[model samples]
Target: MNPFSVFLRARYGKCFASREAIARHQQQAFAHLRRHIMPRSPFYKDFADQPYENWPMMNKALMMEHFTDINTAGITKEDALDIALTSEEKRDFAPMIGQVAVGLSTGTSGQRGLFASNKRERALWAALMLGRFSPSFLRSQRVCLFLRANNMLYERLGNALISFEFYDLLQAFDLHLPRLNKQNPTVLIAPAQILRLLAHAQNDGAIDIQPRCIISVAEVLSPEDEVAITDVFGVEVDQVYQCTEGVLGMTCRAGSLHLNEAYVHIERDIIDEASGAFAPIITDLTRETQPVLKYRLDDILIPDDEPCPCGCASLRLKRIEGRCDDILYWQKHDGGLQMIPSDLIRQAVATSQCEIRDYRAVQVGQHLLKIWLDTDDFALACQYVEQNLLMEAAKLNTQLPELNFHQGITSHLDQKRRRVIAK
Candidate 1:
């Protein structure tokens, strides 16, 4: 990355005069991408002069199939995968292919995503993350991150001003408590599940530490969990909506989840107009090693049209409503299919008027919804949750799915939590 680009982005990336200004900035960035970056890649060189929309839509499997061609770096997919797998197995993610670091995404089932990030990309990422979320530039800050796997890109974040530490999620999570307490980090970044565990630990007086910022990443953070964490920590939990694709979005100072429009251009694949829910097709301006243009992710996002009080001209999200495949469809009175967001199911369980610890809902059949609830009163929780879901179905004028309730939590700590599932 250019020194000037890194400096300006880290300083005033989030500040936008207006929405139109954001668009104009994106236009210039995309043009630069086409002119300077695309020609280097054999795959994209052909499309350098074409409109961005004319480019082929990319997904995990397709990206992997053409990985050797898609990446600007001369590294082959087989070589990259070997490095990533070795890193994962040895639990040491410091190795890389030259200056480019390779990481794998444990995407849906058998389809895995291979991502390559150069030194510049890593530095740019550090700049953006520290710019918006870091407590202070002058003060030496310790940052703790928990993840299933580590990568060289993450290791690059460590420097004189920032003490970066990665807690391996594959290891026993309980073992991390002592280190966490000792570090007393200024920033805590982890999946929502790990953050919840820490929150519980804090609430139970098992551990004592108060970080300046708590960031939820990888997994979707429910509204209920967010409030519960805020109440326990006495600080609002921030969220960084990211995946192997890139750092797509993060929570603004006002605590609203806004797209990283300063660095990435996102095109909406509208799923539902009524709720403004859409899947994102991203074209990251900063990515040069592996260009992620018009790459559509399976995640479904509900966008907030109302401008945030912080006045960020970037797009704001109401919530991430799980994956597109996780979305359940019900039969309407008119015999049409009605799409139901995962949030509606989550809300039904959250507001069931019963004290609940954890829950998971899966659609086993067209009209069969399998649910698991962890609560003191299983019967009452089931009855209220079923009633709430039925009421919501009635409001939608759609047929209600049969609720089959079980009595325990189905999620494991090490794995990414998927509270809502559709099959």
Candidate 2:
């Protein structure tokens, strides 16, 4: 079957079916994709003889090193990067090499990554996204997507029933507000930080659009930001966990984040078994242009303990913990390094008695920690945060680092919002 047909079946037919059925569908898709990719992609040629499960894992570094040979689209890293960079600089998403679209990652993981997709892939992506993201596929709706960079993948969503608009994040919010209010989009998608800003705007009556479906993407949706956005919008905010690699997961009707098992297979690199925290080793079966077989991602995710009420048998995720790079390392008593989970630090700050509005923790040096707190009572919030962090460190059997409180810390427009950063 064609990719579009597969996407339609997965989106319209089998999405709400039993887990066994979905698994069978995925198995078939995986087999077909493996057969298709092995012949075209030189990077996977060595693993052609090996079982899919026995294949070696690939990472960003490995992908960058073998970029010329890995992609089946016949585009070099230099040419693709040139196109992507030019598009970013000129704010022109229409530039493409033949029928393939080249896009660059935000480089939050230290090294930026490039991705390419042909026309068929973009069409399939649009169909699948519409089926999963749109509130009602039958009814016509308008979509407003705020992104750091625009691409043909998003632009193709515009059709008779759906109107797609891309709002560049680099542009000021004030400039977009008037246009957004005029668009009156039925579906609004933006990063959590931008959503927070929009929430404030809506509260202040600066914007007057009521979207039926609101999605938080690009950034981790903090609990506080989620509540604020949901409360202001008067609707449950959904999330799309997409990256440079592929579309990994999206929120279901029951508000549970379920992995897109039909398009990808995930292997957990477990970090905390008790909490179901692990990094994802993804094998994106739908991708033929750029084969992503056994690719390890840096983002940490917590799998759901119970089955989703919606009964979609795909794997469910409880939460998206920050990146592994954000996990701070501390010196152990035995001269070894011990890692502190970002969740622990977030919990320490979130559970404080003070009315903490926003906060960030940065590990500046080996034994120094800088914290930024945005609250009415900065002194009290700072004191409470310090005490809680000290308690958390004590529980982890590590000495507390020297703590410094900072005020008015902000994330730049071009940078990814990270609550816990290790410098």
Task: Evaluate all candidate structures by whole-model CA lDDT and list the values in order.
Answer: 0.87, 0.83
Q: Which regions of candidate 1 deviate over 4 angstroms?
A: 1-14, 108-110
Kindly list the per-residue Cα lDDT of model 1 for residues 314-366, writing each as its tens digit: 89999888888888999899998899988888888888888988899989768
- lDDT comparing candidate 2 with the true structure: 0.83
State the TM-score for model 2: 0.92
The prediction achieving the highest lDDT against the true structure is 1
Models 1 onward score TM values of: 0.96, 0.92
Root-mean-square deviation of Cα positions for candidate 1 versus the true structure, in angstroms: 1.5
lDDT of 2 by residue, 278-318 (tens): 99999887788888888999988888857888877888987
Candidate 1 structure lDDT: 0.87
